[model samples]
Target: MVFEPDRLPVPAPVIMIVEPYGGSIRQQNPNLPMVFWDDAALTRGDGIFETLLIREGRICNLERHGARFKASAALLGLPEPILADWEKATHMALEAWFSHPHAGEASCTWTLSRGRASTGLASGWLVVQPISAEKIRQREQGVSVMTSSRGYTVEDYLPGIDVATGEAKGKIPKNPAPWMTVGAKTLAYAANMAALRYANANGFDDVIFTDGERVLEGATSTVVSFKGDKLRTPTPGGDILPGTTQAALFEYASAKGWRCKARELSLDHLYGADSVWLVSSVRIATRVTKLDGQKLPKPNNEKEIRALINKALG
Candidate 1:
């Protein structure tokens, strides 16, 4: 069976196209043709994007998303996004989306791509849609995850690092390779989506990618495990995209006197943790109830953990 993501019961999403040259925002019909066939974003996936949560007319965690957006652009060698312009487009899309009869949380994704080779200008746009019930359900009820090998080792990113022992062979190189696109949230997500499909085909809600020896991250979310008073996530660098939600949670948890750290995580850590969660911008926090068909132990203080995650999410 194919895994299909849940969709909102809407006719069409609100689309705000950002002009390639002057940075002007224009509303377009979702059913209409807007992007050109020759656009590199379509042809080569030569672009980057960020998905942000919109609650009560406000975009949650804009600063973190913006930082990651810029970082992805820098990694992809794309032009820096104009924050003011994107902010304006976000509001415009939100206004358009809310003008409809929709309710509940929504999301806005900003996409920037290299323009047609003939034109040399860039293309940018924003898409606003309501968050689906499936995501809400997963956030509330938790998920059953399957682990899949990412085929490459973390050592590819953090050179000389041992996946099993979590030991560095030597000082990691300052730069690995530009083509790696390790941390950038680029449009080239076919592999990631394929991983999700494989997991779904195997009767799993989501996938946690591992390098055959050590865990990496979720397909689209971050892998975070709580043991004792400490909150630990996979160390972010070339192996995976740095998680904005995880970073925010760590900051809030740290202020609340919870120990937070990033390190090379193993499957044993999750299987042995008090509780495991998959965190992302839209989903916020979703507990992992099972891994690879084995039931995980319940969290000792699930209620308190949920409360803290809700507070941190807000």
Candidate 2:
């Protein structure tokens, strides 16, 4: 089918914001009411969101995602969300999306904003119907990646200096103001989209970001890989948002007898790894075929890693 960004339905999801005083639910979209968010998230990027993959109408690894979302919100000083209510909202959103005729196999996003201007915490939801099954299919063939140099990394967590913008690739000009939500999955994603556009312009599928000279993550996914029996990823110690998929993979790798470590990684380590994969809810595990202009040797253990992920998801 032709890829139409607007027609895509929201994947099954919901969001809520809970503060010390009270909480509110944001389920008002007719098609995917539970997936709606307020303008604060859109305009000011003052919110956090979770993108989840629904298989057979079931949210995968939801608890992990929720916990991480809460952590990110706390980092940004947003009100903590009610996890139980959010989970119910997610189910409601998913049911609405799946019931729609146009809804195909797809992914969905759940966003929580701080209230409105008067309150300081507001949340919203959006469910994009599925489009471009081909795009999902292409992930299996691996992807080409480009790198960006515009972002920063925080090696150690200090008060008030938590925000880090890792890279910007395309039309979205770098913001002169320091955005507080850079490390959170806030709605201000123009920077991430710009990186994606940069990758597309360069004939690649995505962009991996770096802080200074250390590898961070992709515009939309977390980077991980196996180097001879060792599985490694960039530690969340820096500005990188800790990813749910990355956490799950670590568990799976450990159960499968692989040594897992989280540390700082440089571009040199990424280019020389036996296999480099990007992890997220929808894409799951997509191998990186090339970086910059260098083609990497296909990992001899691709099948094993895939199996590990499949088992974890199950």
Candidate 3:
């Protein structure tokens, strides 16, 4: 395994603020500083979270992330997080980030988890920190992706349906599995992190997961592709997490004369695409210049894409 200390900065004295049980807000110095032997979020990963970009003073796509956060919480059987709670906590985190020595481009993460329900408390916290320059460089220079199997097919999440989009008809499947927790951005991300680590250990920058024969998503980002004036991503009906950045990019690109679609994708399709990308809130859209050690067909246009996305994203 490669240890790239420069690439991943070890956080020092993590500054964070919290609003426990949706009550009065409080701040914590250096790390969470909480004793949670019974916390479901930590032990069982029974929680929901959202990582959002704080551009200037605005939470990029607050409404979109808020909706997803609430939905995920509800699916996980945790207390729903209201938008106001997140907004209040986010501003507090921004305050902490600005005071930090390494602050620049900022990212905020809000986590709402199942706490001691008998005590009528649910654990929630919002922490803001610097967006790493190495992460930005991945977007600036592009990243390589390696495909990994999800073990579960798309049917485990969204059964019997193919294409989906935020604007598509019947986007959410009928009778989705409650235990599946598909499309919900929950704190149960160990598998996702493991996939990324596996890719990193093998020399790839990131991972693209596949369900059965179809490509699903990047470990922490949405897999996006462009072919013949079409911007395409795997449909949420395929149980892929609906990416806020990917959807926003599609909308932004649409205004710029690019047609966008959310549909079923296969590895073969990506291999034949003109260009590919892995998009997330902080990373925006990072070009996939190489996949599985083989250079992809398209020449990288990250500069042009980044400028357009940055303008649109900001």
Best by TM-score: 1
Which residues of candidate 2, in runs, are more than 4 Å off? 1-38, 100-104, 118-121, 126-128, 131-135, 152-155, 160-183
Q: Write the per-residue lDDT of candidate 2 for residues 1-314, one digit (tens) a residue.
A: 78886555545333232222344544553443332244466557667778877776677888888877776777677767767766766676667676765555566676667645654545445453463465576568888888887464443334323332233312333553434334566666788898888789879988888876788888888999779989899876435767788888898778879899988899999877899998888888888888987898797777877888766765
Summarize candidate 1's per-residue lDDT along 97-149 as a digit string, tens digits: 87776444788899999988888888999898877788999988999999988
Question: By lDDT, highest first, what's the ranking?
Answer: 1, 3, 2
Candidate 3's C-alpha runs over 4 A off are 1-17, 100-102, 117-120, 154-177, 298-301
Q: How would you encode candidate 3's per-residue C-alpha lDDT over 6-114 as one tens digit per residue?
A: 5654344333445544567766775446636777777777778898988876789788888778777665677767678668867776776666544556788888877
Error of 3 at 158 (Å): 5.5
Best by lDDT: 1
Relative to the true structure, how large is the alpha-carbon lDDT of every model?
Answer: 0.82, 0.69, 0.74
Model 1 CA lDDT for position 241? 68
lDDT of 3 at 301: 57
The alpha-carbon lDDT assigned to residue 208 of candidate 1 equals 95
Name the candidate, 1 or 2, with the larger TM-score value. 1
